[model samples]
Target: MKKKAMASFLIGYTLLFTGSVYWHGQQFSQPIASDAGQLLPTAVKSIEQAEGEKQLQEMVRRANRTGDKLSIAGMQHSQGGHTYYPGGTIIDMKKYNKILQFDPKRQTITVQAGATWDDIQRRINPYGLSVKVMQSQNIFTIGGALSVNVHGRDIHYGSLIDTVESFRLLTAAGEIINVSREENKELFPLVIGGYGLFGIILDVTFSLAKDELYETHTRVIDYSQYSSYFQNAVNSSQVKMHLARISVAPDTFLREMYVTDWTNAKDEHKLTAYNQLKEDRIIAAPKLLLGLSRYSDWGKDKFWELQRTYMKKGNGKLETRNNVMRSETAFMEYESSSRTEVLQEYFVPVSEFADYIDDLRNVLENEKDFNLLNITVRYVGKDEQAVLSYAKVDMFALVLLINQGRSSKDMKQTEEVIRKMIDITLQHNGSYYLPYYSYPTKDQFDTAYPHSKEFFRMKRKYDPDERFMNFFYREYGQ
Candidate 1:
């Protein structure tokens, strides 16, 4: 039981994780300080007991009466980085995990908030069903995924919220309320990506595609042809399941086109899945050398080898989707950037895609010391399920894996690059995805999520005592 309890640390590291990680009755070790993919801090970790309605209600009353912060729980993968702790109590929901029910006829399942994608995967693998959308990684909890309304390689699968049929929210008033598409449709729209601000999501019901799904196809294109190539791929009739474009163009070649395709879930492209599942292997090279590829045309074969060797360690012809998302062995082993303090995941409306791309390229070229890696452009459809939802349109999400680990001057340059990215996205009437690491000015957030007022209103109606604010709340929350 003690060893089982230590799994809660997967949430990543923070400078001051609260002192609460004991389960069934054993504490976890203090996490080593490094920038590598982090583990949950030893502090504030606790086992997730099955607190009945009465117990939950009593806890709420005590919190409300004393104005003590409630322990907020869910998957803690905020790209905004280390923004949720210290004074804000944590509710580690790892053990609250359970597969409540599966409606095979409806392709939907109701599960506890703490269930990870992996947990869901193991259960559904035999039945051949899977969530419609998942992040680049699958280690996050279901509640966290729904709260953020995550998206992925598929343009048509919709964000995670689109698949949610219902969610049971435990209000700050200790009221256990059941909400769904048919009931409390009002709350459904707001709470999906509303973050845990509305209530503690006890369980969620969402649609899943049967394993009979298939994704077949792959095309590597240049960015110069992005306008023509991307729209064509999205509009393609040949591809069925997955459709995305990755830039394999020369780093100096701004015109990297999409490397994308379609696959079937049930059919299991064993060939394709095999490679994706393989773990990444990196040969730790100096950080500076890594930056040179973006500015110069390191030969495609050379860069490809460099990436494959450094990331995959060797050949990975026999990998799986789960492997692709789970393994972080590709990241540098050296201490993660001390300066790695900010992240910005923004979404622009479909109509603004072209302008946004042009603007992004201009910023990268013109901004001094502006280092950007892993620029991922994904598409998302409308989700009425979440008012603060960033997927209001077919979103062309330009994920900026920017490098900010440098001196103050370099950091300032990084900020300007982010500022440019945000300003342009906002000007185009786009919204910001709040889950990732970011340091957007309050004004930017306000403009990006003006409907945040509705989220605030929902929180007041339910979590009035302000028990669940995260690092994000430090500046803009109650």
Candidate 2:
């Protein structure tokens, strides 16, 4: 009987190992690309995921010695080539993740650059604290988030830089410098939203918020009414968080919109442990829906409608702030072989929100091949610190999730439509985000970010050799 049991266990183990190898092999053999799975060469030299600051420094030193360029990556979610360089050293920052410290009294947490917001939440939730600002999703690493100066649903907070207390930066010349608003004030803005060009981020200290219970509510309204609705009913101290979703279907399109609100809950109960909420439980259904939506437009429309009507109808569902902020499994399930989904964001002044939406609808409606999966609108106040800051003025951010084929022809068509979209944004005196694909021309980029000249000039002054570089700089750093 003992021999039979051993045989059974060994056979089961062997099958599991074989299956794991096959799954990994499929993923590896598909292609060499970013998360978007577009604009990639055949392969890269190698990837080294640094485990700590020592390892990261050694890798940078080796690259400097060998005259090899280095690419910085954490989660590699930036659809464009900002995180990669062909035939260059790739320093993967995910393994370097570590939470250094948490001060409950001060309501601040200090963490390694690679630590994700999810990591921070796990430690601070017990203390009844939450992050002040982060992107809608929490899967991105702290370093990557700061690199982009990401924003969140918090209408009051502008961007990640606002909540940042300080950070340690490892320069290309192998010098670790501490920067903040009060100390090393000049370099502070350069590093934030700098896209990791100036140097490597060691760790960051961020301010935290109280973790209180929130009651959520949802309503559908016309796109035209959003501006006045926001002024009259939405923008107030009572509303803690809010976001609007617009229909992408060709028929109704941008005409219809829905607003979801999360306010401070009046009656609260014992909060659930952050670790106990299984993130994967809510992701499977959405992944399956997305896969099915790929087959038909009606399926896609149904998915969006379902999301607004049923999924987002909070109806006073009480949840802790930490629970509402947790998005570990929110956006990590896009694993497709044939097609890839990429993000594009445009920031228009709040007053021009409706007009911008009208123009976006016209282009999306006219472009036959443009497959817009989702559109989310968030309010962001002006942020002047980040040199390449996208939110230069009080604006409404139009975040678009687009799906496209892997072929160059399809990408070209997508780029053409995106150029038109950029043109529309430019006409409205807005700017496009730099984290996505390299679709915008040099002229468009300059128009959007007029500070590029000064930004690159500072980059040259700091790293004269241009040792720190990425695809974004290569294309538009002139």
Candidate 3:
């Protein structure tokens, strides 16, 4: 009898322990931080999923009743403090992700706000379809992409807003509104790039394009000749995608550039399935190169040389649209806890591309201890819809990817470089992206985004208590 009782007690204890462990694991998961690992903040509460419209409404209503500020987060890739509010409620949208509808004939997809581009690609690729516009990587959520109004290498498409057919937004008052170019026109621009200040994105419907085969081509040209080269070669060609990479080595510096152009190819049979390429190796190579490049200038030169050589193929090699569009872990390589990599983008008028590059090179050369890893140039046409549009005019966006130590001193130096870059951008009648670090002063912010005051007024009208707030709005919305 004693032995039987002991055995039963042990079994009960083991079961209880196992159940508790599982429960705690699910309940006490740590709060998420931005990709840069810089903007981690503790929230008073977090809701992982809305489950449905009624649940989302209840969550928002509860937050409003308790006078709690609510912050919306998707993949949390934005470097700035956009994902979390201090001691506030964070609504994690990842679990809410779902493909709500797909119209194969119209080539359109309507998805829950939390669905990442990767999710969309997986679903659409089987049909030989691809997203019309997205950032280079596929990890970002559609809602996050819309909030930032991301642009890609598609020079013709301009920005994500250009492809968006419509989206449903849940206001602070728990009312869901459908906004598009034709309907609810007043809220269209504001909500697209509003950075989740006005409302919570519920679902997004966007147009898609048929994936096609492309032939890869490249040309190494002087930085000064890029503008003319693009106008003559790229603009006239049937190129579907294009971007130019400028060397960051001290020797070659910004003087040399490699243009990678993908033009439509006749050989459709060469198109490969989206999942075939071993992205781990493809992604790991760059991270390894970047790590080595941080040590010496030789490493930097060799890395750039390798990139040009490896990426370029002699004229007839076929590349699929999805292959070019898919990038898995290339941007997710910051392994150092003491240092981080950040991105800054500036859009300059097409005419000012050369001058802006020159000034940028000068500023970078003058700055000490600056790790200018890469500079990618992308062409963007005018996007007049977004109230705080980055590409107000047809422009060439210069994207700078740099590394900085986490120390305060390194951050200060980084800020100095950023300020000088911003000043140069302003001098050239350009605007800088606001999604990264909050280095720009209020004056710079106002000058870059003059229509922000109106955007803030709309926020006030929509969210009377300023319920939806983040670092970007806190710093610049006023």
How high is the CA lDDT of each candidate model? 0.58, 0.78, 0.79
Model 3, position 198, has a per-residue lDDT of 83
lDDT of 3 by residue, 1-478 (tens): 2565335323432321110000112454644334343623343445345577778878888878998888888877777877666656677787779999998899999999989888888888877788889998777888889999999988779889999999998898878888988888889999988899988999999999988888888888899998888888887779889988989987789999999888988767656642343253335566556556755577688888877776665556676777677745542354444566778998899888888889888878877589888888989988877998998888889888887777888888888889998999999999999888788999999999999999999989989988887888888886
Better model by TM-score, 1 or 3?
3
- Cα error, residue 182 of model 3, in Å, equals 2.8
In order, what is each prediction's RMSD in angstroms? 8.0, 7.4, 9.8
lDDT per residue (tens digit) for residues 1-478 in model 1: 1332222212222123222223221443422111111322324322234455465567666667776564455555464423235434455565667899987778888888888877776676555455667886666788778777788765667777767778898877777889987887778877777666666788888787755334334455555555455567554654443333334334533455444444333445553334323334553342323433333334332453354334333222232344433435233222232334334677877666666667767766666566454556666767655677776666667665554554657656666667777888888888777865445777888898777776777767765567666545555655
Clashes of each: 54, 0, 0
lDDT of 2 by residue, 1-478 (tens): 2565335323432321110000112446332534444445424456677787777787777777888777787876776777777666667788788898899999989999889988988888777888878987777899999998898887878988999999999888877889999888899998999998988899999999988777888898899989888877867568888788888765578898888878877775545432243363445555545444545577577777777766466687877777777644432245334456778999998888889888878887788778888888888889987888888888889898887877889889989999999999999989999898888989999999989999999999998878777888989994
Which one wins on lDDT? Answer: 3
lDDT of 3 at 193: 85
- Model 2: which ten-residue window has the lowest total lDDT? 16-25
